[model samples]
Target: MTTALVTGPTSGLGRQFAIQLAAAGHDLILVSRDETRLTELSMELSESYGTDSEIIPTDLSDRDQLAVVEARLADP
Candidate 1:
């Protein structure tokens, strides 16, 4: 299965992207600033679409957290 790592997925375009990507049969790695929203969305997407969804609550504006995210993506 293909995986998509989507940043800022707790609201707006990012939220929609997560939903759509889940619907499209992609496993999702959802990143957002809101932990509650991220958990909620992860549950909703997993239940509704029968797809795996992982949440990483992160503030991308922070350089350290952004580096972590980049490292995760770059992992083999």
Candidate 2:
């Protein structure tokens, strides 16, 4: 199973990308400042497509948070 990392996954293209990827049977690493929305989307994807997601509550504008995301990407 492939895993995809998506930033700003709570809305717009990122959200659509996550959905499409989930439909195609990819596990997800979803990143966003909005943890609630991320959790909602994760649950929705899981229920809809049996998708599994790891949500990261991150604001990429913060360097420290961005570093966390970078590390996850490197190792995930």
Candidate 3:
């Protein structure tokens, strides 16, 4: 199964990307500072597209947290 990690995916263009990618059958790893919005988006994607998604609420500017996302991208 293919996966795409998307940053700032709680709204606007980022949210659109998440939706489109879910439609395209990519399991999503979503990053956003807003946990509530991220969870909402994940549920919507699952209901709308039947695609599974994981949410990581984080500020990507932090080096340690950025590394966590980087690891997921690199290993996934």
Query: Residues 13-53, candidate 1, lDDT per residue (tens digit)?
Result: 99899999999999999888899999999999999999998
Higher-TM-score candidate of 1 and 2: 2
Per-residue lDDT, model 1, residue 62, is: 95
The per-model lDDT (C-alpha) reads 0.90, 0.95, 0.91
> Candidate 1 or 2, higher lDDT?
2
Q: Candidate 1 clashing pairs? A: none
Which residue pairs show backbone clashes in model 3? none
Alpha-carbon deviation at 27 in model 1, angstroms: 0.4
Query: How do the residues 1-76 of candidate 3 rate in per-residue lDDT, one tens digit apiece?
Result: 8988899899889999998999999999999889999999999999999999999988999999888878877775
Give the CA lDDT, 0 to 100, for residue 48 in model 2. Answer: 98
TM for candidate 3 is: 0.89
Clashes of each: 0, 0, 0
Clashes of 1: 0
The TM-score values for the models, in the order shown, are: 0.92, 0.94, 0.89
Candidate 3 regions off by >4 Å?
none
